[model samples]
Target chain A: EAGVVQSPRYKIIEKKQPVAFWCNPISGHNTLYWYLQNLGQGPELLIRYENEEAVDDSQLPKDRFSAERLKGVDSTLKIQPAELGDSAVYLCASSLGLSSDYQETQYFGPGTRLLVL
Target chain B: AQSVTQLDSQVPVFEEAPVELRCNYSSSVSVYLFWYVQYPNQGLQLLLKYLSGSTLVESINGFEAEFNKSQTSFHLRKPSVHISDTAEYFCAVSARGGDDKIIFGKGTRLHILP
Candidate 1:
């Protein structure tokens, strides 16, 4: 089976501009996650969606960051008025479900590297 | 709050040598531990994980990890490492009965010398 897929693997934009990253989760996966990975650091969860509903988004910056998963298969992460500090790798991951046994593993996409000048 | 710590930023080892990567986690409740590897320009991949039952878990490629409740540590080990083992390894943790939010460590870059 094909793994998770992401588009626009790399993106560059100036500060105050708007940027968006897209992701397609693996087939039959019910949980999708968006994470931000900065240089020399590990990934941090930005938001999580169970099916079409965003079950967790407390870590997302509401002022400038927004995300949505339509049809519970594809997801889009948008950052408006991007700042230099927002430059990082936006990663998308998916899992079979949220059960304790299922949360143990997740498949990750190649990720979109965003550079804000 | 839950957090993970990878004690080493980088580890250099010769081919066919034994290697160990240290990881420690802090959580008030029961936790699940995981190890992930990332290749050049590639996404993270699950190497191994420990949820319950046997405190020891092994990946297909000769890698193993032992979860020690006393030390609060889950360390990754390999009897013999190959050149292709060079990559960034991340340690992660999440609460057992809580939201499935995972927290990752800074990551350790394994450098295999020829």
Candidate 2:
């Protein structure tokens, strides 16, 4: 069984530039998530998708960050006009079920490391 | 809202020595707990979790965690660690019902010495 897949394992961009990260979750997984991890910090959820519906997105920065899970199989997280503080690893995770009472284990991708100059 | 806290930012121990990584959480309602480990330049992996029954949970790789409801803490421990155990450990918590969005703590870097 293949695990979660992400592209552009590493990205370097200047401040004020636009950057996007992509993620393809495991086959048959129904839940997908996007998380951000800064140096020395744990991953924080930016958005979550249950199929094509976004169940939660309160933590996402509306001004500069946007995410979409079209068709609910793959997801894209975008940060336009990036800032120096935005440099971090963008991790994507997936789970088989939507509820913790069910299949709660989350499998993560290699993550896209972003370095904003 | 739920939040997780990992007390130690880094822990260094010699090979074969026992180690413990402390974690605490705050929440008004019931929650599910998890421990994730990440190697250098890698993604996170599930170490263990505490859901409904069994306050004590063990991972296949010799790591274990006990959930303390009174103290609201879940600390990861290994009886004897190896150099391969070196990694970043994160503690996370999520609400029992509603949404399963997890809140993670600042990671703890575990370095196993030779």
* Per-residue C-alpha lDDT of model 1 across residues A11-111, encoded as one tens digit per residue: 99999999999999999988899999999999999998889989889999999999989798999999999999999999999998756333548999999
Candidate 1 accuracy as lDDT: 0.92
Worst 10 residues of 1 chain A by lDDT: A96-105
Residue-level lDDT of model 2, residues B1-67, one tens digit each, is 8899998999999999999999999999898999999988778999999988999999999999999
Interface RMSD after interface superposition, model 1: 2.2
All candidates' chain B TM-scores are 0.97, 0.97
TM-score of 2: 0.96
Interface RMSD of every predicted model, in angstroms: 2.2, 2.5
Model 1 residue B20 CA deviation (Å) reads 0.6
Residue range A61-94, candidate 2, lDDT tens digits: 9999999988979999999999999999999999
What are the RMSDs of all candidates, in order? 1.2, 1.5
